[model samples]
Target chain A: MKISIKRQYFIEQLNHCLKAISPRTTLPILNGIKIDVSDDQMILTGSDSEISIEITIPAEIDNEEILEIEEPGSVVLTGRFFVDIIKKLSGDFVDLETTENFQTKITAGKSEFNLSGNDSNQYPLLPEVNDADSLVLSSAVLKTIINQTNFAVSLSETRPVLTGVNWNFNKDNISFTATDSHRLALRRLLDKTFNTEISNAIIPGKSLSELSKILTDSDEDVEINLSQNQVLFTYGNMRFISRLLEGNYPDTSRLFPENYETKVSVNNSEFYHAIDRVSLLAREGGNNVIRMTVENNNVELTSNSPEVGTVNEAVNASAIEGEDIKISFNSKYMMEALRAIQDEEVTIEFFGTMRPFTITPSESSEVVQLILPIRTY
Target chain B: MKISIKRQYFIEQLNHCLKAISPRTTLPILNGIKIDVSDDQMILTGSDSEISIEITIPAEIDNEEILEIEEPGSVVLTGRFFVDIIKKLSGDFVDLETTENFQTKITAGKSEFNLSGNDSNQYPLLPEVNDADSLVLSSAVLKTIINQTNFAVSLSETRPVLTGVNWNFNKDNISFTATDSHRLALRRLLDKTFNTEISNAIIPGKSLSELSKILTDSDEDVEINLSQNQVLFTYGNMRFISRLLEGNYPDTSRLFPENYETKVSVNNSEFYHAIDRVSLLAREGGNNVIRMTVENNNVELTSNSPEVGTVNEAVNASAIEGEDIKISFNSKYMMEALRAIQDEEVTIEFFGTMRPFTITPSESSEVVQLILPIRTY
Candidate 1:
């Protein structure tokens, strides 16, 4: 491949492409990024068996020439070194040329690099997905959905299905849920609709987390195509494909309690800070458990480590209803849930001292976080 | 201690004091910070056997009351936990009271902490240093001296003396030098004299690094007292004591080359960036060595990893003198020396292809960095 491209533009595309190249890939070819040059555009592809990212840079963009292709060819270059070289080259434009022997020469300003390249044909082919069954959602909305629930996914591999976020689409409403048995996070979007039949998919939380990072924050729609075992996301000039976990996700709809014995509404920041301080002592105590007691208009949080110290903090709640209750739970889980609320005020509903409790944003009911109390007799 | 102090003001003092507490101290008491409160002021002290820091927060400063002493007492609290609690407390003022049996109560806003404290009498006393023989230097100057030479110190404990920065005050000049036997960094200040006899001391680079962080950037003089085995630095309302490295530091004055076969002047940034990029290949090669060849006004830098690739960069020098020469050296050492120069234009003097070279600012002679060339076939 022979091409001349803007350094800044090339660096941006390379960053997105490198995300798919995993550091511990067993296949040596997966450690390299494949670049294909043609008369109309250049396509860069990076993959690590499970996820692949391909981006296209057109010959001209926004009435400005972005690339000039002298010859059409292909080569695979080591991803890490290629990215670092392009970033540090001191020039406005970079020229890349591949020889018949698969040797690539990269030149920018007065700096020149010659790297041994692998045959592009050796790279794995991207999985093809039929577009007949597809769903569309804005990149911004998709990113928010992933961020709100991905953290609650199980980090252990004992139950592989729980390590993924379960997505269910019905009629015009879509819901995303993730659970680790101890806690659960669910987010629902009411306005999104699918043109195809109802669909359900379990996407690895790690994959969704990586996808969220590469997706733009713009309102442009991202077209997603689903197959029997893989999913494809197409946005702008980039295509991201990830494999779906092969298993049935446990039903979590029954995890949310239908009734509450106590409810407390408190300012998010005030309550968050109080728990954060108490967690310091809790963390030292090995279990990271803190007790929360509500009475009238006051909520008291307490944690202690015999060797370190004990902390007691009281934050005023906006309102309290139902019976007063005392509950003990892992402070870390509560803190993570509170951070994901993204609201000024949050309402927490408790069923008793041992049952799971749910926290919801005071302004919206689309997001819910549920936590199981720890027994600390 | 029984005292009501502003949280911000108290946190600042606590941070400075905690710097001396080491996490892996054999003596448990050394891991705690001692708080001694008197009618006039409250002193916070932390020690790790190698270094000790004592900071005093006066009851009043600049005609403004910063602390109110309700009762006079002393207690030693766990350093890490104490700092964390104070930082997270949401209050303008914090009240600390020592109860019977050494239990301490800390109250701020609606947050209260009860910590088991040790008897202050168990803490080691600060070493008494005679002020009869002392040297004074501005904190800014000391900080600059540490920054310029500390990076060159040996990180390995094979040679204990080389792990410290050697300070020699003689006549009307003071010189600080550090070397790991591969490269040497020396900084000299002229026209600065001391009131006592000339002295030589080797201060551990790690201790100097911590001292530099706690020292103010102002030009206020920092009184340094030299004892047989320890050094004391007093500034404002703080006293810092550090144990001196007991060994003879190798004299580095003879290491600087007296003559040169080649001299090159180049823009500091240009040279630095080129070396940084070329080093990527050198690092992958396992030796991290790069070669530089200079003739006339052109300089070429090249590095290669047989399995990875090769990079060659050419930069134009402002001027080149004497015979043409080619030298290979560790790129990391060269990059660090160039960064320490802090000058727009730098002059590099080379003795031969294998001898050591010196880098210094084009306009000043106060600082010099000498690097030993690596032999590359």
Candidate 2:
């Protein structure tokens, strides 16, 4: 394949593809990025078994010639070197061509790099998804949902399904849920046009996180298609496909508490800072257990390390209803949950002392964060 | 002891002192910062045996009350935790008070922290430097000289003196030299006023690096004092004391070659970029060796990895005299030397294929960089 493209734009696209390239040594060929030069566009593809990303640079963009194609062919070049070379090349445009013995020559300005290439055929092909069954969502909403719920996914391999965030699409709404058994996060988009319905599509948390980073906050639409074992997300000129987790997702609807023994509403920033300061001492212990006592309308947070000292902080509580209670929990889990909550004030609902508590935006029920209290009796 | 200070300025000073406090577990009291509040000024000091930093905050600066010392006393607080607490505290000013048993209480806004404190008397005292015999130089010049030569210091402890940069303060000029046997960097400041002469004061590279970071580029003067086995650097309200390496520094004046067989001058930026590109491929091997061939005023740079391919690049030469030569050296060393030369054009002199060559700014001889060529044949 022979193609010349703008160095800056190509570098950006190559960086996107690099998000899917893993440095794992299991597969030697997977370390290279597959490049295809078509008659009208040049495509770059990268994969790491579980996730694959492909980006296309058309010959012309916005009436400007972005790429010039000489011959339509395909080759795979080492991902890291190719990227570094392009980024450091001193020119406005970069030329890439393949030679005999799968050798690729890249030139820009007065610099030339000859890199050994792997056979494109040896690279794994992205899983094909049927586009007929797909749902469209705004990129902003998709990014927000991913950032909010993806963090709670279990990072262990014991339960594979728990390592993914479950996406359930119904006729009227779409719901996203992630839980690591100790904590859970659920976000819902109440009304959006959906062409299909999915009961259980467990998307890997890593994939969602990467996709969220790639998807800049925009009003543009992103079409998501789900197959039996693969899901494809197409936005702009890029396609991101991820292998779905193979297992059944547990029903967590019952885990969220409906009736609570105590509920408190506090300013988000004040409470987050208070807990953060207290956690500095709590973090000395691996469990990071910090206690919150709410009596009347006063909320006191305290944590102590055995050898180090203690920290006691009080945050303003705007509303305190039902019975007052004292609860202990992992400070890190609560901080993570609070960071995902996008609101000025948050209301936390506690079910007695040992049961889990839920923190949600005080204005709406669209987002819910639940954390199990540490039994530090 | 009781005091109230602005958290912002306090944090900045604490960070400077933190540089001296290493978590090496050699001395338990070294992990804490000793704070002493006199009648009008508050002093913070941290030491890790080898290096000690002391910062002073006056009761009033520029007609602004930065500190309010209710009483005069001293206490030692955990360096890391104290800094972290002050950074996260929610208030403009933080109140600190010490009670019996050396227990310290820190309060800001509604947050209160009681931390275990070490006895201030146990903190190691900084080495005393005779301020009468000292030289003063601009902070900017000191920073520049440190940055130019500090990188060449040997990181290995095989020879203790080699791990420190030798500073020779002569009557006419001040010279800074550092070498790791493979490469050497020397920077000289001509026509500087000197109070005394220093023949062999080897300041540790780690200490220089930390001191360089603390000294910002400014016209403010920095006082340098060298005593028996310690060097004191005083600037503004901060006094940085670093223990001198207790060994004789080798005479490296003979290392600079003269009457070169080949001489070449090239654009510094272009040549540096070429070597950087070639090094990308060369770095695959640990040595990072790249070859430079100069013929008919044309410079060609190339590097190859056994399994990977090669990189070839050319940089424009402004002047080429003497005999044409082929030399190979570590690209990283050459690149680092090039970075220290602040001139747009650089001159390189080569004696032979395997001899140590010199790279100096074409405009001035204030800075000189020498690197030993790798023997490929």
Question: lDDT tens string, model 1, A215-248?
Answer: 8788999999888788899989999999998888
lDDT digits (tens) for residues B1-377 of candidate 1: 68899899888889999899999999999889999998788989999999999998898899888999989999999998889999999878999999987999999988999999999999998888777867888999888888899999999999999999998887878888999999999998888766555378899999999999987789999999987788899988899999999988887777887878899999999999999999988987787899999866678999988888888999778888988988999999999999888789999999998899999999999889999999977
The CAPRI quality class of candidate 2 comes to high
The RMSD of every model to the true structure, in order and in angstroms, is 1.8, 1.3
Q: Where does candidate 2 stray beyond 4 Å?
A: A193-197, B193-198
True lDDT of residue B191, candidate 1: 84
lDDT of each: 0.90, 0.90
Error of 1 at B147 (Å): 1.4
Spell out the clash pairs found in candidate 2: none
Q: What lDDT tens digits, residue by residue, belong to model 2 across residues B1-377? A: 99999999999999999999999858999999999999999999999999999999999999999999998899999898789999999888999999998888999999999888878998877889988887788899889999999999999999989999998867688788999999999998888746565565899999999999999999899998888889999999999999999888889988887899999999999999989989998986556999999887788999887678888998788888898888999998999999999999999999999899999999898999999999987
Where is model 2 chain A poorest over a 10-residue stretch in terms of lDDT?
A191-200
- Specify the poorest-scoring 10-residue window by lDDT in model 2 chain B: B191-200
